[model samples]
Every structure is written in C-alpha cells, then in structure tokens.
Target: MGVERYNDLFITEKQKIFISDFNNNVKYFPDNVHFTLAGEISSDPGNLGSGGGWHRDSPYTNQFKTIIYLTDVGENNGPFQYIRGSHKKSGYKLINKVLKEYDYGENRFSDDEILSIVNNIDGFKISTITGKAGDLILVNTRGLHRGAPLTEGTRKAVTTYSFRNKIPNKFYKT
Candidate 1:
C-alpha cells in the first residue's frame, strides 16, 4: 500500500483535521502506536501511583494526543481521566506551584497537589472516560490527565502522538 493509504488506515478525517487545526499551520507527524498487552505493564496494574499517575505531557508547551481504545474499558480497566478545564484554567498559579515542586521535564503530580489547585476553580470536574473498543479520544496532553489504575481485567489502546515542532520522542506508560 502507499504511504497515504497506510496513514488512512489509522488517521481518521477528524483526527487529521483536529491535529492540523489544533496546532495551527505547524507541521505534524501522526504516529500509530499499539502497545501494552495484558501483563505487559505490570501483573498488578494498580501498583500504587507509580505508573498511571496524573501528569501533563509538556507542562510548558502545547501538546496533543489521540487515543483509540482497543479493548473494553471500565473504571477498573484503566479508563482515561481528565480534569476538565485544566487545559485553560489555573494559569500560572498551577504552573508555578508545580514547577516549585517538580522540574519542567518531570511534571507528574500527586493527587493532593492537583486536587488542591483544581478545587479552587469552579466548573473543573473530573471526567473519567470509559468506553468500548474502537472509541476515539482526543486529548490535550498539556492538561492534567491520567489513565485510572486497573484493578481487574486488562486495557489496551492505540495512541497517536502529534507534535507541532520536531522534538525528542517521549512515551508514557499506559
């Protein structure tokens, strides 16, 4: 198959359009990634807050990612969770607080630290997205988000990481 055909197999029209528009006219490369089988990450997926904890992809830059669920995802199967309005709310207050505790490259946050900031902002609700296989999820990775810890069963997903400018590759454990 041709290169465009290969991309067509994974990049939906909406995904292409959104990524292009979301990052303005900047260039982007879509990476179709399949990973994390059952028992691949950890025998106990919910191993404390070590793996699937709350974080922002690039706390100081714009980041976009699209995910497709390859398996049924319930609360216990590691649903994707987002702190609504986090992409735009809290402003420097959030960044300042996080930077003081963590460097820009390491942007993971503890539950108490994240909650303490968002709680002050009105309309910032936590949205846990649980869906069936083949569901498409678009996320602003610069916002505070995470995959809920799995307690039973397994969760598998394919992700497309989009970037405006070329940068070093980074991957987060599911």
Candidate 2:
C-alpha cells in the first residue's frame, strides 16, 4: 500500500514520521538506480514454515533495503543481526568466497562464520539490531543480513528494496 497506511501499522508516531522521510529519499533515488518493493515480514503467512536465518540479500549492485519493525523484538523473538557498513567493502562475490571457505562443504555459512567474516574484515562492524515497535534499519542490499529465530510473540516488520535498473533474468535455474 501507501506509506501513510504503513505509518499506522507501526507502533509509534515518531517512527511514522521518520518513515515518511525515508520514503522521500527513496523517491529521489538516482535514475541509474531502481527502487525495490517494500513490504512486511511476519511469521504468519509467508513465514509460516520458514525460519529466515543469518544470510545476506541476493548479491547484486546498487541495491539496498530498509526494514521497519511493527512489533517488539528481542532475543526470544527473531531479531535482525547485521554487519554495519559491510556493504561498503564486500559484495556478492567476496561474501560467497567467505562462505565457501568457512562452510567447507556445507554450501551455507553458519551464523558464527558469518559473524566472523564481518568482524575480521578491515572495516567490518557487526551488530544485532533490537528495538521497540518503531525501530527501523536501512541496509545496503549488498550488505550481509538475515532474520533471527522467532521464539516469542510473532515478529512483524516491513521491508523495502531499491536497485539499479538491469535486464531481467531470462534463464531459469532448477
């Protein structure tokens, strides 16, 4: 829907106001950039059987995402864990290398390995973003990120992404 509708879904007024500004900044994204969709992430329908663990967004250039909480978050409930500014240096290629090396033959990197990669990086800073209903996290899509496990009350949040215009994928992979 619209930002105004999303404003009401948030738990606080200040958050609503801040999101409004966020929307503006998104609208002004340079023509060279393409804005991605913004929406909610809840353990209700879409997340019914999924446990989004620590992982970064699809490795792509000129892409970014913003996450807004509509519910309280804590250690019990899955909260977002991220590596601050990781987007500034590493990208999809580098991240894959780190994962491949750390995961061995697992194909997927474990949480510890992910954190280690971020921490060991030259300018890396890892953080777990926990906040009340109104907190928001803006992430560089190229940055590493993932949802924490939900152990308590349902977790509700909205996410939006922006990206540079590029040709759509024409091939399908099985």
Candidate 3:
C-alpha cells in the first residue's frame, strides 16, 4: 500500500512539477527519497505522534521534505506548523543544544521544552499552515516544526523525505 502511494506520487504531473521547481531552486538534489502516508485521527490532544513533536529529521545533516495534504487542513485539524527562519545555522545550533539537554531518548521535544526554546530565540515566528487538499509545502526538516495536534476530524497527508550525505565524495558531485 505504501509503495503504491509512493509510486503514484512519483508519476503524478503535479508532483513532478513541484519537484522540478524545487530542484531548480535548491543546491542539492532531492535524492534518497521515501514517502509515508499519515492518516491521523488522534483523540488525545497531547499525544505527539511520530511527526507531531518539535524535532528535526536529522540532528547533524541537511534534509528536506515535501508534505502534500490529501485532506483539507484547518486550525482544528492537524495543521503543519513551523518556526519561520529556524533553518539557519544559529537557529539549528540553538535547537540542537536544547534537544541534547532534554534528550528523552525518543528524539522528540516536549511542548514545554519547545516553548522554552522558542522563547529564547529572538524574532522567532510560528506559522500554522492550513490548506486545502493538494496544497504542497516544502520544508527544511532540520528546523523546529511539528504536526499540530488534532482537536477533531482526521488529517491525511503524504510526506516525502529527501536526504543527502553532507560529506563530499571524491568520485561523485554532490
């Protein structure tokens, strides 16, 4: 089922256009990619599911992700939220330090910890993205972001993860 969805996304014209546009603007190719379909309908508001807590996809590497909403997302539903401009080196360092200190073994930051970190960062802005089906969001997952908890209704989406090794290889151009 997952593979089928991924293949569908790969062949879709809309997705192709998105990827092409993204590739044109970014330095690295969106290679080593994988996708997942999240159909979350959590009744517990506090439960930070796999992608629900404030966390980075990788601690020390650069990675990107594209999230396409399959269902209409509202504030009450699980909207994709991000701390704007948090992908910079300083922001990354700050977040990494906080996560290391509060490392709970799960690689996810608690709400209090996330809030505290946000408070410490000057001019930090949290953006809640609510969109209709087919809306696409490109994000650097090395920043502070999360899937906001759902108060009601289901939130379905497909997220593609693309990662590249930071170390330069002598044989291949990164």
- In model 2, which runs have C-alpha deviations exceeding 4 angstroms? 1-17, 23-28, 31-51, 90-108, 115-119, 122-125, 165-174
Q: Clashing residue pairs in candidate 2, if any?
A: 34-163, 36-161, 36-162, 38-160
lDDT of each: 0.62, 0.55, 0.67
Tens-place lDDT digits, model 1, residues 1-174: 112334454545765566446445433334322222121222284454213688887777656666667678887777889886676645545555644655545578888876776666556667999998778787777788888777877777656555544434443322
Which structure among the candidates has the greatest lDDT?
A: 3
- Judged by TM-score relative to the true structure, which candidate is superior, 1 or 3? 3
Candidate 3: lDDT of 142? Answer: 68
> What tens digits encode model 3's per-residue C-alpha lDDT throughout 3-97?
43546643368775785577445676544544344454554756554386777666555567778788899987788888887767787666657
Model 3 spans with C-alpha error above 4 angstroms: 1-12, 23-25, 30-46, 96-106, 165-174
Model 2 lDDT per residue over 1-174, tens place: 234343444335665456445644664354332222334444453342112555545443435556777678876566787666655533444555665644322323466877667755655655768888767886654565667655556676666444445423531121
Output the number of the TM-score-best candidate. 3
Error of model 1, residue 55, in angstroms: 0.6
lDDT for 32 in candidate 1 is 24
